[model samples]
Target: MKKLLSILTLSLFVFTSCNDVIDIEQPGTLLAENAFKTVEDLQLGVSGIYNRLDNTTQIRFNSVYTDELAIGDDSGGQNVTQYSLFLTPTSGMAATLWNGSYITLNQINKILVAAESIPVATGEQADYNNAIAELKAIRAYIHFMLTTYFTTDYTDDSALGVIALSTIPGLNEDLPRNTNGEVFAMIDADLTAAAAGLSNQSSRTFISRDFITALRARMAAYRGQYTAADGYAATLMANYSIANQTQFFNMWSDTDDTEIIFELERNVGDTYDRQATGGGGWAGSLFAFVNSTASGSPFMEMSRSLYNQLDAVAGDVRLARYIDPSSTISATPTTSTDDYLVTRKYPGHQSQPLMNDIKLFRTAEMLFIRAEAAADANNLGGAATYIKQLRDARFGAAQPLPTYASQQEAFAAILAERRLELAFEGHRWVDIKRLGARANVSIDRDPIDCTVFNACSLSNSDHRFTMPIPLGAIDVDAALVQNPGY
Candidate 1:
């Protein structure tokens, strides 16, 4: 795949029309072709792929584009107004997600293609392969996320689609979307390779065997393959334990937390400054403000159902940690009604404080995946066990595990637990999408003219789910097709 990197880099230069300056170099040095020959070179090249996630264009803004959170009321007069789901094709959130994911995919593919030629006997060859495997897994993950948002049904089995470019050479080459099945197949293939290469290896918080296993479980669950999903999740949960509640919440603040399977770390100096202010800095400043009075921003109020769910469970520490009572903010003389109630997940830099680590995967989610998968496999008791394991830690040991009469009941509990646990982490939409198959809840956003309360009822059939392919992409490739209702 090393060759692929040079090809892609060269393609970028060619397409950008920079060939005129190619020959005006200074004294002789290692050519671009020979630069990545050593293990360190290969390791550095792979690191470049991991580094891309820190870019605001990719990681920071991309999460918001997913169903994690909408453009809160504060975005009424900002550059991100286009990001609201109520808006159409021009939404910055949608466009950034579409473009950024593809850019990362292209880079991953370049690494995958280039690393193939470098032999394992070379000092970096094994590490290079491992990095390539992780990158492939990450690329697959990105594709899976895009497919979830862009396609109506994965079970449709016949929906033709393309999610960015998976593996195409040359710059400005317009590519069509692959089918849902094709995309899923590609994702599965990549993950399978990742699992094999990453097995039993010790590495930092980039990717590991357990991480790939958890991802496999998640993908399988989405595909409705309950048995396989449950099995994979069970293995991981049994081998890797969930962190305690303090660790669960505090891990985000500590870059080297054991529970974090994969994370994008930020340093305290140059790296930190770059992430905080550079073009890559997409810390959801507006959303942060809305969620906290400390930031002097309005609050993105919680849905009535969500607020009630947390409130109904007495002594639920999550509610205290997750939601600040209206009175608490009201106590502050400067607080406005708009800032009365906001999510406590992200407390901004001034409140709970902000850390530079962007968590990619964690062990807590693995437990939830196990619970859901176990329920699907008719192991309601097992499902409840896993759910209570997490809940007991959060609520306290005195609280009894919520009992369920049947697998269906346990399934409902699992869903609710996911919502409460994973809120604002960008897993809500996918959970909704998967559950919508069994539950009556609709996944669509309301029309632009609708009021906020009424707007929440939009159906899963809403056109906004399948974001429009970027205008730039459509204009370049005649073969490219747009999603329906765009």
Candidate 2:
């Protein structure tokens, strides 16, 4: 593990400062020809690729930049600029998102290229094919994230999307951004090829057929294809059961995977053991310097608005699962420092503080997707039923089913439910960006939380909703067009 981390750390430094949009420099230890000589070698290479995948950047950007979190007492100007609605082409988060994703994509492309030349033995063919399928699945997922964050409009096919890199680019090749239509076409092709080669697997830590389904479900929902999203989500809902209160609590402790569909496993002394500023870090470290506690130097706390919403629920287990037990919740949090509201969502696992697995997909998200689809189709009652079904599991008892009079009301209810359910899992920002205008809502930080910077709200239609193309990439290639209003 130490040796692999050393190689990856060095490789990441090279990848981050490359002149090309997607550069490939071989790691010092493993050359492509010698890396994939056998099925075992291919499997090892895939594991290394998986190490490059982390959502800490998205989680941090979503929480601190949105209404999910507020500046904590321990803050020393960390993310203060972003929390103040200050984003630019040179913003650290933008550059991190662009460079980190392309790095992972390049790694996958490199492995795929090397695997093409491998000699498959009769008995090893299945393993070889499965390895390749997993690579394709991860590639498609990275591209999906890139498109979701970088593209200005998900509904417009002609809108600018990120560069689609299926193969490693030459050192001097400067790639231009592709259209949303082109990127989605590439994603669909990769997913289709992945689905054909993958087989059933029981592990939630690795890519399975269900992972592909979950990705399709999310992509469809983002693209506003309600029918397709509904079908994909329903298949997964039937396969995986939602977690009850006890199961949900255990899930945060890494004691259960009852509701999780896929997560990136983080182990002690692995590639992501330490603090990483942008992409690779413990998800908990994004909020706190040491751990998820008041004394642990938590630089960010759960927003009072979000906490109040959870507290309003009579018996919802998410409130306990999200906030630390040791926190001091003030009756009236008139200021950010009045209440600790320490976040305990990633309390840590395997006796490592703040190092839990990065959960990418869960059955709960699928339920939300179904609810959104129902609302979009004007099946208000059906949408309410799905939301109530989830609430019943969380409260560990039957709850009153909600009612919506209009389609916008149904959408508003669905988005509200999603905000609470998917709180710290990196969905809040994108949720509002895509569904906010439809639901007639946007970022509304509590008066108390935003008093420090006076950045209490952002309109749904604001151009800042779409992240700007990072200046680092643009500086490298002048021809690459930037997102509008950046």
Candidate 3:
């Protein structure tokens, strides 16, 4: 583990030193090929992949383009394209997610190519296999992300997905879109390989076998393969323990928390200044304005309806932990209420206040995925059981078990719970998309709060809900078609 940390520490220097020159398309593949001739080189490639896990573009895009948050009055007119749903093919966030994820993929491919014929030490063969599996899993994860944002339908096998390639293509190559299911198939194959080689190791930052399981559970749920998702999530629940109520809040502040499956670690002395102004760790910076007064405001605020759920969750531990609940901003919305409540959910920082170790997967999310899957499979009791377990952990043991007379009610309850549980962590927008694709649920934005931001309510079928393929990608590859209503 210390070796992994040291490798990351050194590679971060490489990332920062060439910060100005790391073009998303080229991504310095030449450097990777030149560097990776030995086992240590492979280790550095692993570190490189981990270091780029948390990106500012995807984080901001996912957070701002959700129903859980409304644009803050003091947003300084920044990121209005996402907030107002005026995203185009040329949007910055779209370009970032497109280029950034693919860059990581290219780096991973370089490592795999380098290791193909390299001699492995006799006893270290297992380690080499595991490292390769980890890279494949990471590759699958990146592909899934692109599909999640680019594809219109999560369950539609024939739906257009991003440019899917196992190996790095030529710089001038024009790649066509892969079907959503085709992309998922690739992800599944990688995860299957990863699971075999990972050996169920427990590491919060690295891609352990259990982390692959968690990813499978999430992917299954996203794909509406509820039965399979339930099984995968059950395995994880049996293998790993959830953080207790007393430890839940503290978990966000430290990297050693047990609930984390995989996270992007941020160290104070790392080569990159993640805590500095305009740094990569802006997840907390988006909504966390803890020390601000009435005049100084947050970048985003919680939607009023979401806060109402938080308000009614009956002794919600997250209220004080995640939401301030009481704050006055001198703006259109005088006091923070349903429309403008600030969130501290993604304040998963350590070492420094501003730099947060970005959480990629957590046990709590898997449990929720399990509950939703159960509900989808018409196992309401099973759904309620997981939901009750999570609520008890969040709101306290005394909180009454919820009763649902119908599957629709159960679904609604689970959706509401997800909103409260996963707000500002980048799940709200996709949840809305999945629910919309599966059950035709519309996203009703706050009319009052979003009015000034030029934002309006979005229907389940709104074309803007799914991100448009970035124009930069199409400019390079004209075969790539733009999403509807872009």
Candidate 4:
């Protein structure tokens, strides 16, 4: 995927021209003739869409709104309001995700339309089909993410999901929210087309059939389709191995790809290589003002609760990989100013500070999904086996197998494992939203970290679990419905 960056200039030109035409001129006429002329142009359009797939917005919101992080010493009142659980239609994360997703979706639609007009020449149909498949895969992923954050109930197909934008709409088109079933049907169709059309790709950074499989696994898990989720996850697990301790340590620095199934590549001089003061940039910049060390101007540190959990796992590689060694350890951290658990999870790569690739799907997550599925099926022993397998890999030895007394206990154990493995990677809030209630868990912040505002715990039943439709979108279309309790 390094070639993705080499063609950035051309992709940008094509993307910008298409966007300008869509905004000002009518649809389906001059833009296709101007922007996309050949198979090469469509491929560049795919690159342009890939450039917009970012996870920083979700990472920032998940960490700040949940118990994964605490305000650092270098904080200048950044994200304090959000950390205190004040979410609304005007929230920055909601607006960023909503607007960014739609903008990229619009790009995908434009490229798909343009691809229809370009006639495939001899031996170029593969490239043409691949480019289209990549766009659909990306489109499916973006729609899935929107539903993940916005849908009121993942288990209820009849529930309202985000508006399903399959094609470019008129300028004044104010589409109503679609049901979860409708949006999911669109996602399935796109993924089916993508999986059939895409060639087998081994690069972890690019979209491939494996990427579709992983997304399907995650989506199925979110929807509580345990059997389907297990099958999808098992297929991926059989193909990709969990990273060993050494590989796991190297993974944070972008030196290892043993477990990564899909990740967005962030190279030097790319669009997200800079300090993302707004929303879409290096993920590490979400926690720190500078880098991932104590010397770096960190504005947020690992939460004491999360740190304690990692520390408790004796000889666990995750503890060493996640916490910076330069952190100042306090015997009793009773206040916000006491202990600082600096995070090293994104310790730069390629001479870039605080910049690393955003990993979307990993084999370790597949293991967790399998564990959850096992627990959901009342297979407590199977759930424990999966947990022990993951723990044994992280610890670099055969550890004692965990035992579960009941299905609830097994689910709780799986949730705990997910927290340790996927910390600071943008899964905490959604994890809590989807599984906390069943496990009898919630966002439990450290008392010291919550001393400022006492916003320590949030139940999964809270309406804030579902993000409100952004105020920017609702401001124009007053008829658009917002999430409950907004």
Return the TM-score for each candidate structure.
Answer: 0.78, 0.93, 0.87, 0.94
* Per-model CA lDDT versus the true structure: 0.57, 0.85, 0.69, 0.85
Candidate 2 residue spans exceeding 4 A from truth:
1-31
Candidate 4, number of clashes: 0
Candidate 2 — worst ten consecutive residues by lDDT sum? 13-22
Name the candidate, 1 or 3, with the larger TM-score value.
3
Candidate 4 residue-wise lDDT, 307-370, digit = tens: 8888885899999998888998787777878887898888889898889999999999999999
Q: Which residue pairs collide in model 2, if any?
A: none
lDDT by residue (1-486, candidate 3, tens digit) is: 122222332342254432332323344433544555556556656766676776555566666776777666567665567778777888777777777677667667767887786677778777777778889889988998888889988888998988776875654466788888788888888888887877447777788887787888888888888888888888888866677777777766673477777777766666443432233654566665542222336667766656666776467787766765455433354334434465666554444544567677888888888878877878888778878888888765755667777677777777778777776667877887887545445666656656676666777678877888887677667567888887
Give the residue spans of candidate 3 off by over 4 A.
1-14, 17-33, 275-279, 288-297, 329-340, 346-351, 437-440
Instruction: Give a tens-digit lDDT track for model 1, residues 117-145.
Output: 65567455566667667777788778877
Instruction: Give the worst 10-residue stretch by lDDT in candidate 3.
Output: 1-10
Q: Which stretches of candidate 1 lie over 4 Å from their true place?
A: 1-35, 54-84, 116-122, 163-166, 170-174, 199-204, 255-258, 270-286, 289-305, 324-339, 342-344, 347-353, 378-381, 403-410, 443-454
In candidate 2, how many Å is residue 137 off?
0.8
List per-candidate RMSD values in Å: 5.9, 4.8, 5.9, 4.8
Ranking by TM-score: 4, 2, 3, 1
Candidate rank order under lDDT: 4, 2, 3, 1
- Residues 243-262, candidate 2: write the lDDT tens digits: 99999999989999998999
Best by TM-score: 4
Question: Candidate 3 lDDT (Cα, whole model)?
Answer: 0.69
True-structure lDDT of candidate 2: 0.85
Better of 1 and 4 by lDDT: 4
